[model samples]
Target: MRWALVGLVTFVLFFPVLAAFFILLPFDRDRKHIHPLISFWAKAVLTVCPLIKVRLEGAEHLKQNGTYVLVANHQSIGDIIAILHLSHSFKFVAKEDLFWIPCLGWALWLAGYIPLVRGDRMSGKRAVDQASGYLKRGVSVLLFPEGTRSPSGEIQAFKVGAFKLAAEVGVPIVPIVIHGTRDFLPKGSRLLARRVQVTVKVGIPQQLAAKNNGSVESFSDQIREEMIQSLKSIRSQFKTGELVSV
Candidate 1:
């Protein structure tokens, strides 16, 4: 029943919003104007599905007018929805297949989000170039450095692309850890869980310098370790009810 309501909302809002996006494109060349609309759409979807609750913390770490290379651990499709609740404006580095998903894909393209073809060197290079351009233009770009969803909901080995992009563009790397989305909508399942609490913890932005001596791989590992510790902390806080949902 919840899923039906969510779908109904999406179906009703998707077309009109998409049309508005197209009509506004000529005036919104930088695509900055589209993000807030997308964020609103995401919020509306979440609002209709009362079963999935989202809590966000460390939002203070994000500064207005700050460009970031935002990295987050991937758990499920729900992670995207949960992250959209953030007030920060950013472009997502999403998989190419997601760009083929009807209205959702079209919206992504029109919004100037980067699409990556996994395992394709040329595609990855293109995505990096595009994301770097956005950062250079003072827009944040979000990527799941794990490259794909972690089936077991554990922090997987980090991929170096996100860190490399940050290093290239000289932007701060902000680590965001999301928990409980794996249970909300696990991989390989179309059905949403009946009730789930999703928490997103945004960590302080770490500026990349010569600390790793130009070794993006090592830097990526360092960031991943910090996120691993963050995940542990979020779980502990959730259990003890230490976090205040915002």
Candidate 2:
């Protein structure tokens, strides 16, 4: 019931902002104009959810003016709010199904978020192409290479599309490690819980060189490795029960 209310109030309160963003769609081709409003909505949601506290680290590594393909592990629906807290303006490479949602979906479309139809080869290629265009235009796009939320909160193997898009655009890749969202709202459930400390680590951007053979498989593996180490470091904190002071 708590999460339900959060969702309801979030939509109700933010509906006007969403409509305004939609009206500005013509001028928000790069999504730069609407990002701050989106950030405000996301931050508002987190503020209303008293149980979740976010601690961000390594954000200094994110350059204020640099463009990147930001990749992160997806643990639960809450990851979206957590990532938005970073306040970095990036369009999310989201699932096509999400675009069908009423107001929220319309807002995403107006803001230029790219959507991908899972398991469709053609849709994947189109998504990569769309993301490439956004990158070339000096906009960063966020991709969850895991493709879906982790049922076990374990970082899964990455898909190659994000790396491929990065290589195609010749931009650096930024790996973001997220921890504890699963405990806040587990997979397949909307129940909200409190006192959950969500930690986010933004690693230094990495420039990936596409191998001569042109396959980004190795590049994807390298990023997955780096994120795995980050998650491991965060898990150790859980054992100690001493949350970092942010």
Candidate 3:
């Protein structure tokens, strides 16, 4: 019943707002105006659901005036909804298949989010290039460096695309750690569980020395380790009910 109500509310709100975005696309060239609405949609989902409580920490660490390549640990599709708990603005670098979905896909394209075509070298490069363009224009881009959700809700292997993009654009990489989302709505299922608490930890922007002196591979490893540690700390506190911001 909870899942059904949330789904129905999302469908009702998402389609109209998506259409509104389509209408604004031609005039909103830089996509600055449309992205906030996307954020609002994310916030609305969390608001209406009421089944999950979301806590955000270290959002103050995000630079309000600078562009960033934001990377997060992906555990489930519920991570997307949990992201709204953060107040920062970012464009998502999503899979190409997601761009083919009806209303959601159309809205993504209209809002100027970049799409990665997995397994196609040329397509992948083009997508990264486009994301770099957005970064250069001061738009923060979000990517899940694990590339996909972890079946066990553990941090997965990090990919180098996000790090490379940040290095190429001379921007900082902001690592976001998400917790408890998989437990809220695990992968391969749609049921929404009640009274679940999700926490998002935003790490300070990592200005990679690798951008000037080292390899993206090394930078990726460093940031991945930071996120892994952050997740562990958050999980430990959550288990003890002491994960509140100080």
Candidate 4:
């Protein structure tokens, strides 16, 4: 009930601001403050949804404005809000389908997001190349290499695509272990009445070896293991059950 109301209000508030962004795009392409502004708005949305007090650790380890490939375990939609609230130069390489969100979609495109379309080889290649080039231009990328939200919030095997892009772009990977969000809001759950405390553990950045054919695979494994070790209990919570989507 509470979350539903908040979501409705959020949609109402965000749409206008997004509309204004587009309305002014032709007149002025200046969006230097856009990232922080959108982040501030997202924080308000979190406040309204009344997310449990978030406990963030190792945040000091994160570079305030540094560019790196941020790799996090998939949990829930709330993860996106948490990320926007925490990260400074946060940009995402997300599903191509996300481009369909009306106002927000336009904002993301103007903000330089790299869209990933799965199973379409040509389209995927185009997105991958865009990601690689974006890194070269100093844009940081966020990826949920698990491909989809873990229905049970149990960390799944990461696909190799994100890692390959990181290695190709010569950027370090920042592995994040997120906990408790799945319980608060799982995939396909409409009610958001529970207050579930969340924790985000930002691990150290692991730089991949350049020019090594096998190093990318090794680096991906290391990141996966580090996340699993850090999120042991959270993974157990998923044992309760999962609502698998067909």
Instruction: Identify the candidate with maximal TM-score.
Output: 1
By lDDT, the better pick of 3 and 4 is: 3
Model 2 stretches with alpha carbons more than 4 Å out: 1-9, 102-104, 209-215, 244-246
User: Quick one: RMSD of model 1?
Assistant: 2.2
CA lDDT, every model vs. true structure = 0.86, 0.83, 0.80, 0.72
Candidate 3: list runs displaced more than 4 Å.
1-5, 19-23, 100-103, 193-195, 210-213, 243-246
In model 1, pairs of residues that clash are: none
Model 1, span 1-246: residue lDDT tens: 977998888778777677877788888766877887777777888888876888889989999789999999999988887898888889999999888886667767877899999999999989988888889989999999998999999999988888888987888899999998998899888987657788889999987668878788878888999999999998888678885332
The digit string of per-residue lDDT tens for model 4 on 91-153 reads 677778766776456656665566877777887788777767667877777889898889987
lDDT of each residue in 1-246, candidate 2, tens digit only = 777766776777577676777687676667687877777776777777668878889989877678999999999877877887777778898898777876567657766788989999999889888888889998899999999999989999888878888887889999999999998999889687546889989999987754524558888898899899999999998788766522
Per-residue lDDT value at 61 in model 4: 73
Model 3, 18-71: lDDT tens per residue? Answer: 777778768766677776676677677677676676888889997666789999
2 or 3, greater by TM-score: 2
Best by lDDT: 1
Error of 2 at 71 (Å): 0.7
Off by over 4 Å in 4: 1-32, 51-53, 101-110, 209-214, 233-246
TM-scores of all predicted structures: 0.91, 0.87, 0.87, 0.79
